[model samples]
Target: MTDFDATAYLPDDLLERIRSRAAAVDAENRFPTEDLAELTAAGYLSILVPTALGGAGLGLAEAAVLQQRLAGAAPATALAINMHLVWTGVAKVMSDRGIDDLRFVQTGAVAGEVFAFGISEAGNDLVLFGSDTQAVPAADGSYSFTGTKIFTSLGPVWTQLGLHGLDTTDPADPKMVYAFVQRTDAVETRDDWDTVGMRGTQSRTTVLNGAVAPADRVVRRVAPGPNPDPIVFGIFSVFEVLLASVYTGVARRALDLAVAAAKTRTSKKTGRPYSDDPDIRWRVAEMALAYDGLLPQVAAIAHDVDVLVDHGGQWFPRLSGLKHRAVVAAKQIVDDAMLVAGGSSYFQRNELSRLYRDVLAGMFHPSDPESAHATVAAAWLGPVGG
Candidate 1:
């Protein structure tokens, strides 16, 4: 029997650390160093490693729950941890291939060190196939990779690197050889990543030049077989869902502040408490309703993922829909919170302002609004048979 219990996987202590310093965490836009340490020490970073390797061996459902909880405390930290979760998931899946990738897994599981994904490129529109990076084969079947991958979150912090590139030597093979190279003397991280939102992510640019990638480090790209796990979409879903939850928590904080302000402030023109004003009461009510509305949808989608994964059906459409819905709802929820909070919400020091900016990143998730809608439509309406 597996030793995975979904309920016990959350990092409560790390959450406490996040809750305690949330204000300061936003105030400085600093990486959540303390929170990362807590996760590492508590084995939260290794949650997806198979139980045989001394990990929690939980599924994507439990992983989403943990991500959501972490984001509820700190969105920036949650974003960075998403990279760790993706690495752990990849390790677990690779382990099932009947080979020993445990060395890599153990390195990350014990030291709290791994890599951010290297896929996106600068000025590249077609992100899926736009891999400017290249990996050429050597005589001994080893590969030398060279290229710069931009917007790599935790690029500077991780001990390894996950990269994708086309093996042009086999043009007709239709497989872009994927590889993970050790972060030794070959890889370099550029001073980039000053973004509008998610500033705390430290998403720098990584340049790989003649990086030696052993045969064991290479994996197939988007393998299409009888059973494709759709792990990428699953990872994207976790990111979108948790980010929505975190922004919702921030909106909740804003609403709480608005309620307090309404009760205490007496409008000079009306000569009464703001809360007594119909307009003020209406705003508060609207904000509350929006927040309440989003929670159930997010929860229901997460539950569906759990149920589907348990019963064994590919949940591509469902996961895509959940990501789209939750992120869109979070945008609406935060907008309402800002509306109710009024001019005070604009202050940089105000948590709501930071959260408003942070939540916007949800729209750019891999399974974004447009793609997600298309996935659902294709599934429900079927193809045109063209």
Candidate 2:
């Protein structure tokens, strides 16, 4: 626990401030600009970058703990910031294993440059395996990316976007280019992020009209589809674990609120606090059981990633499974908490109601329930009909 103290990174005062603003941010459907500014000034953005590069020099496990704490206060802020952290985490993972390819990413983060993940597309279910975006090579070795990206978190504030595209012009090699493009006139950010939950994220659609990534900035050109490239592992590991951390934090908060309500709210039937009601106590206990189960699993997987413990081909299944369970558990915990809190939590102004909506967003993230089950099944049963 000493290695990863959530409070050490996000103290009470900062969390309270973030929590106080969560409602307004969600109600307005605006980005938590103040939250990001405070976090950046506090060096939260560079948690995964090495100390040599002026960062906190932390690892994925520590980042996970911090992310959980952040989410407890502001799920939208935490989720939006996750896109930036994912790049820095990948840089840390690669650097630890002697790959300096992502050194620039670490340095950029330390310099206060925000990097957003732009891999998710409209219908690209292949995830990182392939890309519908076009990567056309230029005379100077740079590539111009032309395509539309969806759910691009940090879209408005990101100075750099980490994305992937297919370079089919070279029919022989057909490489999938993974690179980062700085914000430019060519990159268009649409004002269309009005969602039911996590409204503060402002995750808008981005149209890349030949957005350019200079030659030196282009990181990888591996063949498309499932490959053993370190970059892929780094991305998948960091993304899934950090994403899970956010929802787990949400569950923790929901459980805390339910317990508090049980102690304060009186039961009409017995004229005693709801805490004295057997049904209320049982529901809270169920929430605690589920919430407690997720913490250790998230910590263990994140620690394994930090220590470079190779799970081989099983890594995807494990990562996806953890994410899937965390989301499902968080959703269930929130639902139970709503019942425990009774009709009071049904109000739009109530924090639990906000959390209930935010937790629903977990289902839409990558390695979703359907995909996670397919992955775990494939790991045990092999390919379908093989």
In order, the Cα lDDT scores of the candidates are 0.66, 0.94
TM-score of 1: 0.80
Over the stretch 104-177, how does candidate 1's per-residue lDDT look in tens digits? 75456655665677766775544544366777888877788898887677655777777777667766664455
lDDT of candidate 2 over 215-261, digit per residue (tens): 98899898998998999999999999999999999999999999999
Cα deviation of 333, candidate 2, in Å: 0.3
> Which one is best on lDDT?
2
Q: Would you list the clashing residue pairs of candidate 1?
A: none
Q: Give stretches of model 2 more than 4 Å off.
A: none
Off by over 4 Å in 1: 1-13, 20-29, 93-103, 123-130, 221-314, 380-385
